[model samples]
Target chain A: MARQKMGGFNAGSMADIAFLLLIFFLVTTTMDTDSGISRKLPPMPEKDQEKSNDKIKERNVFVVLINKNNQLLVEGEPMDVRLLKDKAKEFIDNPANNPKLPEKKITDIDGKYFGHTYFVSKGVISLQNDRGTSYGTYIQVQNELAAAYNELRNGLAMRTFGEKYKELSESKQKLIKKVFPQRISEAEPKNVGGGK
Target chain B: MSKFRTKKDKGTPPISTASLPDIVFMLLFFFMVSTTMRQQDLKIRVHVPAASEIQKLEKKSLVSYIYVGSPLQQYQKIFGTEPRIQLNDAFATTNDIRDYITSEREARDEKEVPYMTTSLKVDEYTKMGVVTDIKQALRKCNALKINYSTRMLSSE
Candidate 1:
């Protein structure tokens, strides 16, 4: 055999192919964003508003409890969800109705009872899954609460303009939304077990 | 002695690579046109649990909700004490979840500034994969600043 010429194999094209693949995947893979109910958090209460002297004294606080069966208990009363929305709307639309308000404002209102400084706490849902409550039932209760919040917000929106909610002017509608935040924020972590 | 030359170059052969760039361009166009553009996928279905003691959130006009979950199945499965659709079962449909989220973002972004934030309330039992799906979808839609709702009382 004639003296063999030892030339290394050219890998330039292989590098080019690899580079092309890198670009391909980079272009093909798409990133996703958080997909959940769009909720705006209430701004921090003013420093003065947070004065400890005010003490968030829990009074007439609406205690709505959701159980593993998705049943709703408003202040220990088993109320229909539709009725709950109307009741909640009445309280939120006019805080004056919150019974927890100072006795003066509570009495000032035409009725003896009125809504108070309502602080719909994040954990207020209080989902108590019984020993055998399936995860599915728990989810249903969650959905219903979400719907109620939406309904309450929508109803308040309607009340603001005394018209169908969808027909309200954009600004007026927005004003209502700012007040409700769709009333759906992030769900608090489950308290897990307890009936108190 | 005169060195033997291979066949004297016939009239300079026309360079064929002048069109090489055009071929590359055509190939690029073909790939772009034929390749299915991968849509950003959400990792999970996030169904926010609702609260009875729900505070009315203000400035809701500036917020948007994205439902990330198994796609809406036409049929409902009555499995347990309460009626709840199964989440992310292999057969559950999820095609619209992404599109719905994308459209909501597009619609809201058009009317409001980009300052709007998204709050995610995923069911505790939802799989991590489903949550990823939701996040990927949100990123594609250009939504940011996800908030998780939690109870101060529970940990206490």
Candidate 2:
């Protein structure tokens, strides 16, 4: 019997298979990266612990209240949301050493992070919002407050190490965070009218 | 000039497409490496708020998403226009958050439980009352590490 010579398989359909895979991946995968503002909530208090009202100085507390209408009442004065960052920075840094501003405590820094001691602010930003406030406004306020802290840390990092805060080593970043700890305390939400 | 003139009878040669499949396969591999498969279909219409101070969440496997928004057009008739919370594939109430957290923790490695993060993707126009309730539920369950999922604000 005489056998026919074998020919190469056609390769034209290879492109079609690749196209099918590409389309499948394009439809199944999401290109958007997830990002957000990270926060750690305070742990639940024990039932047995006494509810002691530890007194905090009025000057050290920066009260930021958002009413039901989404209007800001910062330290009892009506202000715009756009200006909240500068106000927060001023309160945290107290650069002018104003008598009414938060007091600074002289903290001893370990030689590992810094050779000399630094002055750490004792400011605590107390944020209270009404239940009727819009979620957008709430996040805006939180973002502005976080931006204030980041800017202060960046400035200090630049002056001290000539590098950005994010670029610093983890321990060194912790040292800088010690200088300006993000002390935003959120109070429980309250019903302030204008709600169903 | 005559040397450069082409013969009229000999038409232009057809370009070879031997590399076309290779190029397409390269694109397919790139998409497979860089992007992640969508985990679930969204029942709520969520338009996350924007912010400048935001951080990219690391370790996608460790994150548990909590979506808060009004129901889509099809579900609006049954669910009403009010904002609702969605966990995994179904609508959930604030009280369901604790159970959700427990199940999420149980599904992962014990060592990774501490590093687990709960991401709240809330719509911008929704009221804060629902968000606060969710927060309280999370706190009760001892899931303290939370992220308010927001997009990058272009203004900078």
Top DockQ model: 2
TM-score of decoy 1: 0.35
Error of 1 at A87 (Å): 3.8
Model 2, position A8, has a per-residue lDDT of 50
Which candidate number has the best TM-score? 2
Candidate 1 per-residue lDDT, tens place, A1-196, comes to 2345555455446545555754685588433223322333334345567456743334423456555445667656887655755555444444464455312122121121123433332212233334323333344444455555666656665655567555778866655454454433332324334311
Q: What is the TM-score of chain B alone in each candidate?
A: 0.42, 0.90
How much is the lDDT of residue A32 in candidate 2?
82
TM-score of each: 0.35, 0.93
Q: Where does candidate 1 stray beyond 4 Å?
A: A1-36, A41-53, A57-60, A67-72, A77-83, A93-163, A175-191, A194-196, B1-156
Off by over 4 Å in 2: A1-8, A112-116, A194-196, B1-14
Q: In candidate 1, residue B148 scores what lDDT?
A: 42
- What TM-score does chain A of model 1 get? 0.40
| lDDT measured at residue A143 in model 2 versus the true structure, 0 to 100 | 98
Candidate 2 chain A, run of 10 with poorest lDDT: A1-10
